[model samples]
Target: MSDAATPELRRLTTYPVKSLDPQDHDSVAVEHGTLAGDREYAMVAKPPDADHDPTTASVGGQGEYVNGKRTAAVHRLRSSLDREAGVLTLREEGGDETRTFSLDDPDALNDYLSDYFDEPVSVRHEPRGGYPDDREFDGPTLVSTATLREVASWFDMTLDSARRRFRANLEVGGVPAFWEDRLFADHGEAVAFRIGDVELLGCNPCRRCVVPSRDPDTGEETPGFRETFLRERERTLPEWVDSDRFEGNFRLMVNTRISESEWGQRLSVGDGVELLGTRQL
Candidate 1:
């Protein structure tokens, strides 16, 4: 049996494709500054050229990615990856039809997505580190399970909904609410932490976007989500949390970065977490 007082990795989730649903993992290898296969594929918007075929589109382009922050309709689409079979399954929220495509077949995948979003979009793959929100802090995000429960209780939402809303890659158990905040230090400094043999530098709290304010499945905007969350977050703010990192209350989870020395380290679900110390950022 696990000790409730001992901090340990409770869950590991990765989004093979950005803005899609998350996939759980029991173990994952750390590489290129992030977990392998995390955000390895992303849907990229295509340029507004009438003659340009989105099906033939390449990953390289000036267009931005189609993500939940930019497109609410993304919530209506569900996706799952079968890594061994190298296949991707997709389905609409309300539709009964399901579609499956080979991971190597970007043309077909792009075609389906283009129609779903009613715009030109293509799937882009970058095995090296993939696409992370913070360039410097591209390591997997960390959050305490207690924090998720507390946040869910705030809005009368479920733990799964809170997890989807935050989209953290790592979930730690046996810690108090907002305990992950201790992993970061004041501005210009960082906290060094370890999960089993893997060492990561805690950078700062992840600033949330509008995606968290919408329903995870329907994209319906929650009335006063931010307003109510801010109030609750501020009321429960711990003294150990660094105020320097809190530009506002719309932040949760600790963003981290991996050093080259920690590359290839494997993180597991039951790995114990230890806060080693602090380092200059």
Candidate 2:
């Protein structure tokens, strides 16, 4: 499809903290490789015995890392960030009690979270970038609603469920199911895809993790469809689709970093997307 015919930016989701409720916005500020105020802070685990700083602990391995994945109890919780006041509001979905405090107050936040989650944790902030799951704190990930709809077909639930489960920063519409996979180097020349007015590079396919199996809202464990899908021996994929970028047969979503243009710019929900020219790499 031509740039003019490309999909529209359907939605924008920002996570102030890792494994917390996402804030939906119509427009957002993008700066220094991350959405402004997105994943600005996170409650990192402080294990009793750890060599390095607990906040720097790797999440996947047996490091001093903890979040909703470590405890489903955390997923039942929701959070809201007041950037101007530097206050964070935490509440339960089906409850009335709400905790509000300064994002800088890690001690108080830690105590509250420890009491509720029954695990020692400390809150930390990243000014340049938020605490991301990617290798380096890149930026917001873009996923297509059409892709969500197709992936949902592999399960019994609705596409809305996948959206909640996948937890993409940006959801696009009016595009094919796997158009994102072909944006860069699915074949031949590498094309640079533009979001709003930004040309994206550092494209990477997000590998599957156990987090997808956990409910984003309730934090309940499911049948692990994402895990199963990755392990499938055979896949009837498209010809232009880049299978080499994926690993473990279960990869989904494209993570892009380094916007060529549109630096210090604002990306809106209704912004049109297109490809300007061939990307060198």
Which candidate gets the maximum lDDT versus the true structure? 1
Q: Write one digit per residue (lDDT tens) for candidate 1, span 113-214.
A: 898898888777778888887777899999999999999999899999999988999999988888888888888988998999999999999999999888
lDDT (Cα, tens digit) per residue for candidate 2, span 1-281 = 53544688999888887778788999988877767877777766664333454346565554544565566776788888888888889988788999898876556777888777787666767766677777452767887887788777776658877887777888888887766776545323445666786666536666666666776778777786655565431363555655445555566777766553556878789988775655655
**Reference-based TM-score, model 2:** 0.85
TM-scores of the candidates are 0.92, 0.85
In Å, residue 115's CA in model 2 sits off its true spot by 1.1
Task: Give the poorly placed runs of model 2, Cα more than 4 Å off.
Answer: 1-5, 47-56, 59-63, 186-191, 231-236, 259-261, 277-281
**What lDDT does model 2 reach?**
0.70
Q: Where in model 1 is the C-alpha error above 4 Å?
A: 1-4, 47-61
